[model samples]
Target: MNTLLKSQLWRGLLLAICLPGVAMAASIQALNYSSREVDYIAVENPGNTNSGGGGDSIRPYGQGGSICCFTVPEKWHADLKVVVVYQLSPDPTFHRETVSVPQYPDGKAGDIWLIVYEDGSVGAVVSLYGPSRPEWPGKIKGYPVPTKEYRDERRKQKLKREKASLLTVERGLLLRGNSLPDEKVKEIQEIIEFQKKVIQSLEGNP
Candidate 1:
């Protein structure tokens, strides 16, 4: 190893050894790697009054804002784990899981991340660096990347939103009756036609 690398290793070891009783506080954040949308992710940090974390909803391949005040030991323990409660959208129910924290290569402290993987498996990780950085220690590398299923699900959501908007517009036009100008009426008709075609195309998609 080079001079800087060796220095960092020694520093990490020293902190873990010298600060055995020290506790490091880190904020909790959610990273979604699954195709489904995730929301209401609550982490139960035992003995901490601010244990309720993860209210932000994270889209597929996205990260939610961090919640404050969870503490971790200066030194890693074999049984370190967190209790995560979350809900996947359209499911109408919440899930509770106990996720074990992955080992950090350097015994340094950082923020806690609750990850929802592609296969629906969940895990927790601590990193001084973000997943995009090389220093991040985890089985998975890099931030969440969109999958084919995720793209399809997004398209379906867009179609639903558009259809709802179209219904509102149609209702408005009906209420206005012939009071709408001829040119304005024609423009609205053209837009409705275009939207219909778009909706049809999306609905037909597998």
Candidate 2:
């Protein structure tokens, strides 16, 4: 082969090996907890005080509580900033417990409507709702009734409830300082890109 062609081939081979290492550096492995282990996950918002009526069988709280923890890769910890996003409903009448992220070591917990770490890089969105309460004739016994005068108050409330019932979408990322790493962020970028395409395709958007 010609010298210039050989040199180009060598460069391509080197890049192929180095690229995977760069992608692996910023990746995180998330561990979804069972009902028996203790782990710590960070929270975003601090004052959101809602006890989501105990926790359901599917959703557990605290140590031995149902939670998902991310075991961050060691190399990225020092150089990367992790961000968590918590998405919660803005409605005021929901009877569920306040959403929160438990602090590490201290095991302390607090209400955070949504937690965003590293700005918008990485985070988990949580849904907080209460179980249905019993009903009575004059007024639904335990649940509070709306006093708003709007003609479609019930319709508006129904819309809000449906919105609140949505699964909170949480995204996580390992970014360099506050900015996304140029070439280094490719792996995650590809995942995000693919998701965007999938969503657009599903929505029939061009």
Which candidate wins on TM-score?
1
Residue pairs clashing, model 1: none
- Find the number of clashing residue pairs for candidate 1: 0
Score candidate 2 by TM-score against the native.
Answer: 0.17
Writing each residue's lDDT as its tens digit, candidate 1 over 1-206 gives 89999999978855664465677667887888887888667677644536556567898788888887566766678888877778888786887788778777587778888888888777778878888898877668888888877778789899999899889878877888589998988888888888899899998886
At residue 77, candidate 1 shows an lDDT of 81
lDDT of 2 at 41: 32
lDDT of 2 at 135: 18
Q: Give the 10-residue window scoring lowest on summed lDDT in candidate 2.
A: 51-60
In terms of lDDT, the best-performing candidate is 1
RMSD of each predicted structure:
9.4, 25.0
Per-model TM values vs. the true structure: 0.67, 0.17
- Runs in model 2 lying further than 4 Å from the true structure: 1-20, 25-74, 89-206
TM-score for candidate 1:
0.67
Candidate 1: 10-residue stretch with minimal lDDT = 45-54
